[model samples]
Target chain A: MNSRREFLKLAMAGSTAAVAAPAAASAQAKPKRWGMLVDLRKCIGCQACTVACTIENDVPEGQHRTAVPVYELDGPNGPSQAVLPRLCNHCDEPPCIPVCPVNATFKTEEGAVVVDAEQCVACGYCVQACPYEARFINHKTGVADKCTFCVHRTSVGLLPACVETCVGNARVFGDLNDPESEIRKLMAQHETKGLRPEFKTGPNVYYIGLDDRLASTVAVGGGARDLRQGLETSAHGEV
Target chain B: MPAVDLMSFDHEAVWRPWAVAYFLLVGTGAGAALLLAYARLVRIAEAKGALIVAASFALASGLPLLADLHQPARFMHFYLGSAPGSIMWWGSWFLPLFIVSTLLLAFMTGRRGNAPMCGGERMLTMIVGALALCILGYTAGEMSVVAARPVWNTLGFPVVLILTALMSGAGATMIIDSLNGEKGEGRYMLVVTGAATLVAFGLWMLTDTNLSTLAADYAPVGLFGGFIIAGVVVPVVLAVSAKASLLLRGVSGALAVFGALAFRWSTFNGAQLMSKTETAFYGHEAALSQDALRTLAGSAGLLILSLIFVTLLINLLAVRASKQTQA
Candidate 1:
């Protein structure tokens, strides 16, 4: 009888804790939905953001957490260099999430996609499933790594390393949920675009002055791709 | 084109040769298990080779799969967390159960006397057969759902994968029978499945919108030269023409399995070599690392060791039965 009474009291306490948890959560300000906006017009192609990201994330050599791909378009006024700074889109319908066999990768409450190194089995299934080619197996960590939107700094009321170091003020990082945030205001003022709209990934990262011609079809041959291929081929004794 | 890339790095391949080995071994084992089920139902003593191949290959398939992962030791994460949504996670559960069922069936087959199989043994074969199909389905399904890869996501891809597995499985059965100094009926099985595999490939190349667009340029030499000519055409021709020679039959068996491996290499590696963002192919060459070589050797060694175990077990059962008869 005494045991049963104690059990009932414990069950009541547990239910009360569950009920109180959400109430406590609601009392605090709602979590921020972080997103990035890149204004191509402002970008001077200095690659300062890329350098800062590499140093900040400790990404190994010959790999990138973020990089700008420059394309030379054959315009009516002759050829011109165009820059498109690329990183993880942190898609609302992220393909990388469900494909993780261990549930090691997930969208944070603040809307950043992140990988838990400890839980990752490094099967590379998620890497294969990612449409953006954003994720990779980090050689040093031996786990899937991608741009986490620099969550460690963002959570502590600081800007991401890339955004902080951006020379042209091109990369904008802010809370999408907050109405008065700079990203939201910028998004409202301009006709924004996202890469690979055909994929319907619903990318949170918006861009201003994104060239429509550079959407999908890029001409074959020549680039860092060829240079990297030569290095890789030589390394593997294919040369 | 309106634009030329001044600078961009091509995406690198994540799945390697070890993944291909795992798929090949498991598919062969699953196919052999299906054949073993048919043989058990009909009491075809000639298909004893199928039973051995099914158990041994299934047992040997897991190592390469684990080795494919960067964190081979961390596979327990698959079961430690619940992930019903992931096909690979579902495979983690299905694979071990399939292996156990195949092994259990082999054990039961050994213990059963020369008298026809009882109801219990017949039921066991059905269970093993069901699990074998699940393994095949899960493996193919896991690859199919990745819509990111245009070549892999096609409806025809799974059909080709399944047909080739069946073809390889039939070939392995013929190999075991030929080695056992017998003319088995697996030649006809090989012919039909091998032909079906070619038909599936042709259909895939012709029908799949993405593959049809890319097939002319993207299909590497391995598919046409290695898989179709050497793997299917040569072995299939031998299987059809040389009906009496057991040595020729064994040769066909080896070639069929090799063809299946070639198909996987051609498709898995070939599709990955294509740049998702561009029209060009990535420069990828298989570098046989020490780790990959060790895994390959380990799988072969494990198969031979498993074969010895099964041989001794059946022989022991036969000896015990003879002693009981004398008593």
Candidate 2:
């Protein structure tokens, strides 16, 4: 009995060690952590960023890498609109990463969560795991797909397509690890918030002046048509 | 006037019926395998036919899983590129090992007392049983790890599965053994099925203490009530009755099997109904397209086909062994 207990203990420890080892090693070799800040006060809801992201990523029709969902609230000054653009949070502790059976989805040293198309079995585990609803199964590729934070463009020292094309200059993107970067400066100056903060995923995307309507709306999986109707009729309010 | 863009995340049911069917098959298979191993270890002679059925279920569980995958060809990547932390990765490894080991034990047992399993064989059975437990646990863990889905984010999910697996396994064992119309360990298995069902109910009560959207509204009312009526209440009452005919016992066992399948169906589908976001959640309904329905039918057909195939092969081996002994 004692021997059996000992064996179980050792087995448990070994499994834990195997899962933890890679994450610790990756942290030690830390590169520049890329993050984004969206100033909702500055956004005009032009949706140029959305269109640009789709065009740049060659995303199929009826799918989006980034979305600008606008909400209206009843304000003292009458109906006001708040535009909130949503994208992959690229969490430091991504919920989506560990759920992929085939290691198809992983977080880079630079803090972008990426999907390997070739390795993906399209089991959709990551799609279900994501708290932010950031992942979707790509119909054309028959694999899980999501925003890469435009790693291809950012790695080449070019700004992400969304950040470059934002007409209102609402988006600020840079290496969060660099203290001198614009994102770092903005984060220091402004109190920013992440979507669904309670999940504790350690999201990299920060929002300034996030609208209450957009923030407070409970993500209903199926009963959303009524909510969409409510959003359309209500006047927008300031954060 | 600014356009209020109402676009929310896509309400596509990623798991759908394919995933539901896969979970049911795997759980049933694991439960059956564990029971078979236990019977073999104790040298239950009357359980030979059941052993064959159990082993077949265990091995054939891979069918629904493969059918659910969009890229079935990349199935090998589970071995080559498994993410260690993933519960699905653990499942990928645990399942095949369980199947292979169960098959080996079944082969040894099929020799019909000519060559009984030795110490090494018994050891292998124990190990496979242990692996079977892990496989069942992994199935629950797969859903529980998804922090996004509040309904599936608890340990109770796996506990429910474990209990149901044991219950269903006992039922399947009893039914298969009774087919020959010989007196076998039916009463013992009935008692076991009853006990497991009771424990599962206790666990269900505990699971409902903190109800998430998955457990809220119509879901729990149907799920818990359904389990109680079909799985717990019916089986226990039938098992305890004096005039429990073989036909009645068989019916009780069959209910337990169907109950197990229903549990998986409800759990998987119910969890998907709840949204992950904080805003007004978009309601989701799983569309039962003809294609999806056809695939589901195909998966069931595959299970039956494999059972028939394995039985024939086992019979052939038995005949050959007997002929050689006479020679």
Q: Of the candidates shown, which would achieve the greatest TM-score relative to the real structure?
A: 1
Error of model 2, residue A101, in angstroms: 3.0
Candidate 1 segments whose C-alpha is farther than 4 A from its true place: A1-30, A227-239, B42-46, B209-219, B287-295
For every model shown, what is its TM-score relative to the native structure?
Answer: 0.89, 0.83
lDDT of 2 by residue, A98-168 (tens): 78888878888788999989889999899899887778887778888888988898776567888878887
- lDDT digits (tens) for residues B1-327 of candidate 2: 322334454456677677767776667767766776667667544356556656777766787788778888989999886478888898898888877887776666555445555777678778877887898888888887787876677666777677777667666655665565543444466566557656755665565643333444425544555565776668767766724477666767677776776677666766664456543333433334565577568766877886776676666777777888888
Model 2 chain B — which ten-residue stretch has the worst lDDT? B278-287
Candidate that would win on DockQ: 1
Best by lDDT: 1
lDDT of 1 by residue, A1-239 (tens): 01123334545677587777886456337667889999999988888988999999999887788888788877789988898888889999998899889999999998999999999999999888877778889888889999999999878656788888887779888778866667888899999998778777888888999878755545545556557667431132210
Docking class of 2: acceptable
lDDT (tens digit, per residue) of candidate 1 on B1-327: 535567776666788778888898899888888888877676555367887778878888898899889999999999998998999998999899988888777776676645467788778788878888998999899999887788899888898888788778878878988989977656777898889888888888777766754444545456777788888988899999878999999999889988888888767876776666666567655535565466567777877887788767765775776677677
Per-candidate Cα lDDT values, in order, are 0.79, 0.70
Q: What are the RMSDs of all candidates, in order? A: 9.0, 11.9
